[model samples]
Target chain A: MEGLIDGVLPDAAELPGLVADLRTARSGISFVYDVIEKLAERYELSDAVMVLDHPELGRQAFRSARRPIGEASAMHLNVLECPEGVHGVPGGVDPVSASVAVELCRIALDLDLYRHDSRHDGLTGLYNRRFFDVMFRRCASQSARYGWSFSVVIFDIDSFKQLNDRFGHMLGDRVLQVVGAEMHHALRSSDVAGRVGGDEFAILLMRADRENVPAFMSRIRAAVEANMEMSVGFSFGIAEAPVESTDPAELYRLADARLMAAKGTKR
Target chain B: MSVPASSEEVRLAPLGDSGDEDESPPFDALELEIRRLPGVVAVGWHRGEAMRACLSVGGFGLSALRSRAVQLARGHLDEPLSVELSDVEGVFAASSVASVRIIDILVAGGEVEVRLGAGHLIGTGRAGTGPEGAALATIRALDDLGIGASIELRIASAVVLPSDLGLAVVVSVVDRHDGSEHRSIAYASSVEESAAKAVIEAYELIGEQSRDQAQSAIR
Candidate 1:
């Protein structure tokens, strides 16, 4: 591994395969860090960091940098367990160094952000439709493994178009922001809420029964109604995960159809 | 003996000056009377619509009352029913009707005044036609009765489907002064019913008031 790092930067084509090998080996965190550090040293790079998902410590990264004089500088990266990873450089560097370093850091950070964003809505910053698909499968798999149940709730703004017309687009944006915040506040930490479309949101309730859904939805509805601008309310449709459908896509379609049914009956 | 009895007829003065009075102050005799109506639970007054009242009733009659109120209002103001208006001018022209909902109920005297109004349309389903028809209907309804006149209808407690509980009773009254029309709807229901009924009754009350006023003026 040291010899591998001492050579030229891993070919762009080969880096993925090498990373896969490292992952498969279940390489120790220190070993991974050393590999990154040695590579940075060989390339005369400013810095390198290796992060791992640890059972007890969450995600922690060990970073090593090579000074212009070839001395080793090191730091420990501490971050929350949020789905996306955070990155920043400390102290001041010259503009050129800063630009290059920042761009490099962004490239690394973006890998994580993109992974999370793929599962989240860009505008509302809630979980995206893709996230729902992924979560359905993951949750179903977990439920099958654990012999538990999972449920989903599909909610959309009732007559949201009227709101945009009466209050204008800016207020409509405010409404979404307020709704997202309230929903986040309403759910347990274990639960997941994602914005799947312009006015559509979905929630994944772990270990939830069909009976528990109405109460959960009622709480969410009340919270949203109370927190939102005057007279705004939402309609929701709920479906249990494996019970509704084993397939993730089918589960979503079922939930969405139920939501449309609820909307149709509203006078 | 002839000087003992004076011929002068002493008439009681009206509560306030007839002109420029706050027609629907927060608390007044009429407001109190509305609150005391049969089945009424709460009453509020606003100058914009005037005499908003609410009532809670035992039974599906509320829907019938809603249609009847719209009909009676049309007789006086010549404005069509909300559904009819929606069809003719498109739903947006009569958008105000959809905004009304029953909020609460109050019973005062022997009259059962259903309180209605409050809430707004969730979205813009209609075009921009303004409130001409709604305004005209309100003016006509208010013009009909002499001073202290009131109307009552039986209302069934409303039930939002999929939910078992009865929500509330809703009603509205409209009156005219000069050329301007004043209309109000009151709701008499529990806190649970507040969100659904407030918007429905407001529109009904406005339409009813406009028609009543227009008819009275014609007479």
Candidate 2:
């Protein structure tokens, strides 16, 4: 019988890898609770419950597997015997055990949330520079391995200082918000855009080329120009991977040089 | 003025009747002669009823030669030199133009000769009435200077003029080539007087070389 039950259960080895891939704290904890419920089906546990502990919300039960039994308390465990003498757990019972499971789930969820928040920008919701550095290195490595091209387009708001001087910082922030939205709209699903500095944004274009870069820049320029009320335009400098240069530092420097050249011709 | 009175002593010779075609007077020969002149570095010819030579001069002494050629030409031809100096002081005064350290002079034989460096900027706009006009005006001014030459002059250079505003003076001479000479004199500044004289001398040097080259080409 134990062998039959083991055969019916999902292979447990695959569950950990799946759980590790889920970085969202609540989602990860919820996923673990789901696996536990699936495991209980083969064993016919009288009552199975997974609870996650939230520091503020106390213990919260997230999942349960059970069968109804007579004279069980509203929140008590209902362990019933089937016709085959197998004990079955009623759903949403087993209050004490459920509470414990809820507390553990909460702890895991919180940790995942903490990790995510640490790596991302709170306002823009994009990966912060620290994460961007890691991502850039990873992408560069992949590009090197595959002999593919990757490009970074660095954009700066022109005369942002003067805008701030004339309209005050609050309006200046609104300008950034609008421009950021324009950038987001212009990027491809595969591309990543991040606020690398104040009034400066960086985008990573996977496998981009000079032929395509001008088009991309033109779109971004037109978008910003059309949407923003402020008298400003974005200056972009593109540096490609492995083609223009292989080193990320050198790529960025090339982009910077191009940007400076663009600025010289602007006015 | 105690200058030489004899024909041999004079560096300039009158524009004699060569009886050549009005427009095609063996320019190759003329260019060769102008090239052989000591101070004349380059020459260009234009074929018209009035022949002209473009003279590029290297030094100051060549200005005297330019003046003598115009004077001698006027003494022999039907129309002597006519000079016109235009208001081009601004261009003349620019440090960049002056830094070339060269001067361009236009001398008319039949076609006009404008001597400018490869890099010198000669204004050819309506504001300056074009290179041809400047050449004609210089010829008119020559007649005013009593330099006998039947040639029309046009001289324009990017050199500093001596005043805030410059003047354009035209002198017309009638029958100077046929010896029934009449002179028209119009004088403005000493600086212009010297500039016109220098351009004329440069032109003569160019003409002499042109004549020598023509003679050699035929030989």
Give the best candidate by lDDT: 2
lDDT (Cα, tens digit) per residue for candidate 2, span A88-113: 24433233333333333444445534
lDDT of 2 by residue, B25-83 (tens): 12222222232223332233322334444444333234554653343233123333321
For each of the candidates, what fraction of the native contacts does it recover? 0.00, 0.00
Model 2 lDDT at residue A115: 50
The two-chain DockQ for each candidate, comma-separated, is 0.01, 0.00
Tens digit of per-residue lDDT, candidate 1, span B1-219: 001111221111122123112121112222222212211221211122222222221121344333433322221222232311101111111111222223223222322222222111011111111122222222222212111123232222333434555433333323222233333332333422332233234434554454455445444
How close to the true structure is residue A64 of candidate 2, measured as C-alpha lDDT? Answer: 35
CA lDDT scores, all candidates in order: 0.39, 0.43
The residue-level lDDT of candidate 2 at B168 comes to 36
lDDT, candidate 1, residue B100? 27
Cα displacement (Å) at residue B74, model 2:
90
